[model samples]
Target: MTERDFDEIAALALKHTGIVLGRHKANMVYGRIARRLRQTGYRNFADYLEYLKDNFRDESTNFINLITTNLTSFYRESHHFDFLRDTVIPELKKKSDKKVRIWSSGCSIGQEAYTIAFTLAEAHMASAFDVKILATDLDSNVVSTGAEGVYPADSLMSVPDDAVEKFFEKNRTGNQVRVKKSIRDLVHFKRLNLLEGWPMKGKFDVIFCRNVVIYFNRETQKTLFNRYADYLPVGGYLIIGHSESLNGLTDRFKSLGNTIYQKIY
Candidate 1:
């Protein structure tokens, strides 16, 4: 790929998905875009890019899916689940409305949302409250996968034995498992871009946007954090990836440490 081609691809990614792609990402971008070229019958980066610009309305979703990263697993960051079980759920239990909403923003392939469902079930919240988990991603492919709620058996490796037994049902081949209906019923999956408008109307009690903002530039991160704060009320929780922090970004939340923040002002 030419330097100009990479630059154009990077620019499209940033504009559509808010993901920053520096010069170092050229090799990775080349491989991904090359796959698109093969599928679209283009022979070169220049040709594909020109076609992309002309057919953007029809092709943007494929382009976004090709470039955005979706790396996630069930309970990948276990500590966040620990806090949800130990603190968040308990506090939420006291609310008179008995309704709760948790968003797994940037949720990849549904593991994080399922994990949240598992935690809530373990706490008996599903039986006691009106609970729902919204799982969203920029990639339609992953969003569909998440909606299907079926995964390889090994995806449960990090989950506790009892919880796994309770939440998932293995297939006849025993290599895959489907999230039980009881749990699947508590979550909804949709495709969303953080850079675009949100259709959700109510405030969320907890928002888990873990490991998603690291791919964005500082300005984008600042905007997203503020948007998250807007979606949450005072004392509502914002849980981010372990590698991300709110320091010097915004003051609407106070650090609860371990990458957990609560809206205070």
Candidate 2:
């Protein structure tokens, strides 16, 4: 693809999703979009670019999905879940009503959200707690896959045997495992562009936005973190990727170790 074409698409992505692909990302863009070009029988990036400019609604959506990264898995950053089960939930139980609202922002493939559901079910027992997990992603493809709640057996390797037996069913046709309806029902999945205005209502007790903001520019990161603080109640938890830090970002939250932050009232 030409540099101009790269710039155009990158700008459109940034404008729509707050993801900044630097000049060095041109090759990355080429690699990701090239396959789409071939699959659609377009001769080159230029043709694909023209198609995008024409703004066929479905094509545009696919183009955006092509560029967004959706690498995620269940129990990723296990320590965060440990913290949730040990520290965060215990604190929330005291302050919250029976209903606990958690947002898995940038949730990919539903694993993170499902992990939360599983944790809550195990902790509360009998599914008596009014727990709700809202999982959202910028990529519609990943969101759809997450809503399906099926996975390869290998993906469940880290999950405990008892939990697996309780939460998944083996597909006779294949080696896949489908998440039990009870667990799937605990999560609500939606396509959400974080850079856009949020349509969600109500403050959350916890927001897990792991490994997502590393791709955004510093200004975007600051804005996103502030918005997370806004959506959280006082003493609410914000858990980010282990590699991420709020250093030099904002002072709205107090560091609580383990990459966790608490919003001060």
**Candidate that scores best on TM-score:** 1
Name the lDDT value of residue 265 in candidate 2. Answer: 53
Mind sharing the TM-score for model 2? Answer: 0.94
What is the TM-score of each predicted model, taking all chains together? 0.98, 0.94
Cα error of candidate 1 at position 87, Å: 0.6
What tens-digit string does per-residue lDDT give for candidate 1 at 220-250? 9999999999999999999999999998899
* Cα-based lDDT for every prediction: 0.93, 0.88
Please list the residue runs of candidate 2 whose C-alpha ends up more than 4 Å from where it truly belongs after superposition. Answer: none
Once fitted onto the true fold, the runs of candidate 1 whose alpha carbons sit more than 4 angstroms away are: none
- lDDT tens digits, residue span 1-265, model 2: 8888888889888887788899898888889899898889999888888888787575867888987888888888999999989987777667546778899999989999999988888887326567789999989998998999989988998888998888899999768999999889989999998988899889998999999998888999999999999999888899999889998998999999889999985
Which 10-residue window of candidate 2 scores lowest in summed lDDT?
122-131
Best candidate, lDDT-wise? 1
Pairs of residues clashing in candidate 2: none
